[model samples]
Target: MSEQLVEALRGAVGDGHVLTDPDVVEAYAVDWSRRFRGPVLAVVRPADTAEVAAVVSACVTAGVPVLAQGGNTGLVGGSVPGADSAPTVILSTRRLTRLDPVAELAGQVTAGAGVVLADLHRHVRAAGWEYGVDLAARESATVGGTVGTNAGGIRVCCHGMTRAQVVGVEAVLPDGSVISHLGGLPKDNTGYDLTGLLVGSEGTLGVVTAARLRLVRPATGSAVALVGVCDAADALDLVRSSVPRGVRLLAAEIMDAGMLRHVCDVASVPWPLPQQHDHVLLLETESPADGDVAMDLPDDRDVVVALDAADKARFWSYRERAAEATAVLGVPHRFDVSVPMGSWDAFVSDMRARLRGIDEVEEVLVFGHLADGNLHVEVLGPEPEDERADVVVLAAVADHSGSISAEHGVGRAKAAYLALTRSPAEIATMRAIKAALDPHGLFNPGALLPSGPASPSRSS
Candidate 1:
């Protein structure tokens, strides 16, 4: 049956695109974090939406599960197959690379699922516009994967998440029916919003083949400032004050001295400030070139202004290389959480105190998008210490009415912890949705919601 499934996939896509070699398929079996892996029947590379539908149809006929993967750069275990589940086939969208003309769509651009996020940004930028969402993994992250996770990044403070930019989508449902709505309409109240549903389904319901993304005009003028603050509250206050009424804030990122110093050392970039402070804030303000916007940040010695594009990129590079720097230092239990804006400071304080108290915890580094109340915490230590710290961090986030997983979706790794943020009723509703869409669970199998008879779990 497995061999027949492979033969069917090859017929659907192409003989050359169907890879059954363990050496080649192994790379597609794991995720970016190397956290989850599973046995795959074969890796099928589909060139377009029709091919994806054909491949999914073949899996449906064979009673086999199908896992959809894009760039395979998801931090959570969403893109990887379930290790404990029956062998499933991976549908790689790398060959579905097509970027529609910007003029045709006016304020939007339709891109295939295989198009890289960074590449889309560049294509749009050439037309005097931008994709709006900016992530450190843009170069490797695909449009479909980002849309699947509803990704939020550094520019989310101003532009919002991938959901906000996804005006339309093209997907193949579990039954192999293609749902196409790749039209950027300002108002479309025709029926249920399947496009929105597919945006963050994480491949459980269907495969996202392409997307029509909303674009925004480039800021005529922009300024970036690095400021040292007393604490998270101080940094929040500055973020509020720095943005004038007319000016648009591109981003407001906060990083601790430990994280900043580590990134600087790894990137070999000079510290912009003379003395390292406990909290570092990267604030940016932009407006039309003809419009005048005042930058009224607190006057301090640590505040360094980036006068040009190169300087601004240099300052932003420090924040962009944070994850790589931490990885270089060592593997650590990592978390991406968001709390109420009011409890941001308290949550950070509580988490720091709790993590530091753990004997196994060697170091706790923090940084994130301050404007949106999302924080990325990295706890470095042995498995014993890091695992304990994970508990403490999740508890703290919940206590502050925060989400255990913020921008990053609740993939299989975070499935059990969904209770920390969602109530039992909410979880049940999610499960019901999953069952309604993919009744046989032929899609991702185990992911998102908690594992049960209704919905199984992906192997850790």
Candidate 2:
């Protein structure tokens, strides 16, 4: 980076906000993925939307690439910059944390972009309201990042993803212009739903400053159970038999016996898993919204407090610490894939067979939201450079008319296989849209799209 650009940025923001020191720069260079390292010129932490706009305009004029990051907790490498490539400045969103509460005419609370998700949950619950989006990374993940990924969670089947909760958004475009679409439009056939466009664009289209998220009334009662199945086939059958009739299945996460074993060994805690159970299915379902009928529920809310809050959390510790445990085991390649719910069982079987063939693959952990069919597969050790090797699992997932990515965005990690999910026409339209929004390609370049048929391997 040129000294003049640094001086300009220092002039724009105070010396306290602009970090150019090598040690400080290194801290913000990589995201939570730890899959890639970026050589950034500096990381600028702006206080508000105006400051973000000014910094962006400065970077645009300076011909510098600006990589926007929030919480540094994205699974994808969307927040990473190149080390040997042209100077890219990281724009961290941590400093922009703010939550504004509002009540709609229909009576709902909308929050800002920077609010931590778990805090939001507490806030809404205290006020006797609810915002349905829940995820494991609630502590570290920001509301902005969640909205950016349109993040889905354990509650996805009952409510929906982040896209559904967001009624309005206040975003900054690539050109340093603030597009604050805050007013809740009940119905608008006026033009393209720009809010929808920006939601899952992975920061390529724009920066989400704030969002007017939709709210719901709290669930009156809930039931949680660990259903020990004979096998993965039986696990799928339990889902088919139970859900859709009365139970509003909030979550149905599947953990293989190997995963259970790994979790037990890592945490050194006795998991509440059934003996000799091939597959462990942890499910959560809700009772009526009315408090009166909730007590009548087969498993009342106390069951929820006991199982989910205590016993469930004890067992759930294994699931929560899966990422950390796997990191300790060996190098991990996490493939966040999704398919039609109907094909999840078959796809898992096929994937297990393929992975069993690989001598390098020490352990393959399969677990995810079965109702939504978004499976997170972690391959432990041995980096396979072969794209053909990649196709075994990728093709199995694609066989179900599913996506290459469900919650995690298509960053450089999966850019090579992004096309397997979307058609050529769809990808072309996406590229055209990207070119239109970011004419300079200054925002997180070489991500969400492959440079060519073959791309560079990830190195954290």
User: In terms of lDDT, which candidate is strongest?
Assistant: 1
Candidate 1 structure quality by residue, lDDT tens digits, 1-460: 9988889998998899999999999999987766578889999999989999999999999999898898898877888886787888898888889999895456899999999998998999988888888899999899989998999999998899999999999999988899899878878999988888888888898999999999998888888888889778998888777788878888899899889989989988887787778888998888555224347866654788886778888989988889888887666677889988867778888888877778878888889999999999888875622356766888788777888888888777667677777877888887888888788888988778767643322112
Candidate 2 lDDT by residue in tens digits, 12-79: 67788889989878868866656667788888877788878888888888898887787767776776
lDDT, model 1, position 327:
82
Number of backbone collisions per candidate, in order? 0, 1
Enumerate residue pairs that collide in model 1: none
Candidate 1 wrongly placed segments (more than 4 Å):
287-294, 384-387, 453-460
TM-score of each: 0.94, 0.90
Question: Candidate 2: what lDDT?
Answer: 0.73
Candidate 2, which segments miss by more than 4 Å at Cα? 82-85, 288-308, 384-391, 453-460
